[model samples]
Target: MDRTPANDTWFQGKAARSIHEDQLKKVELFNGRAAMIGFVIGVITEGLTGQGILHQIGLGPLVDGYATCSVQMLPFCF
Candidate 1:
């Protein structure tokens, strides 16, 4: 294992060696916090609107439209 300048530079350039464990931990913590916040927001929205998260986002109609079209052989639904 020679510690020459070129070898050191090459090792540094490697993706596996570039990212530190501490950076990954930070990213994980940030993602966890974001998910928690999003879940709280969704719950609040559901409570206020009396609808689940998907319904609040207007996916309910889209999904129902597809189901109805499929079942009844309709051309389109919205």
Candidate 2:
């Protein structure tokens, strides 16, 4: 293959495509890591603030209902 300017131009397109693909992969990786880190921070903050899971999701009554059902089912389990 002759090292001509035309050949260089042809290779440039392929190089640009590979560079673009690498950049996109990097962006995706960064976004995924950022989301995971943010989630961990949020969970840690919530825990430090002393907010229980039921209270956090406004499902306090649901837990009470579950407790009641468990009590009712205790006899059946035996």
Candidate 3:
């Protein structure tokens, strides 16, 4: 039985596409992780800095804005 040349090319294209999709998924995962770390760092820094500034300004050091978020939604994970 002779293998069709077009079938070989199709399989090669499919394999390449699969690899591309995997790479895309990896990049997306990395970006998500980076964003999470950055958000945590930013929140901590902002809380500290704002508390200091508010204290200097004679206002209350702790405020109610710490629990706010940009993309507010129901708890996703915890």
Candidate 4:
């Protein structure tokens, strides 16, 4: 006896080419990786600038302030 699909609505003989296939995840995975790298760079630049401004204005803990700013971007990275 042979087992096969009863309908073609979903399968369409292309099940092997579906996005659900692990290999199809490469595009999305690459995009996510690129976005993560860009986000980290943006966070670092922005935080450093803020810290520089604060220090020039005689504020204390400028480095801590910058570090705190960078922390806020962590959740948004992913």
Collision pairs in model 2? none
lDDT of 2 by residue, 1-78 (tens): 799999999899999999999999999999999999977876886789776556567886766666676665865542
Error of 3 at 18 (Å): 0.5
Compared with the true structure, all predictions reach lDDT values of 0.81, 0.80, 0.70, 0.64
Pick the TM-score winner. 3
TM match of model 2 to true structure: 0.53
TM-score for all predictions? 0.55, 0.53, 0.60, 0.38
Model 4 stretches astray by more than 4 angstroms: 1-12, 15-23, 51-78
Candidate 3 lDDT over residue span 25-76, tens digit each? 9999999999999777767766877554344445542333433523465253
lDDT of 1 by residue, 7-45 (tens): 987887785655766688899999999999999999999
Instruction: Judge candidate 3 at residue 35 and give its lDDT.
Output: 90
Give residue 64's lDDT in candidate 1 (0 to 100): 67
lDDT of 4 by residue, 1-78 (tens): 434565553465567567467675887899899999977776776587754444544764755655576565855543
Runs in model 3 deviating more than 4 A are 51-78
Positional deviation of residue 24's Cα in model 3 after best superposition, in angstroms: 0.8
For lDDT, the strongest prediction is: 1
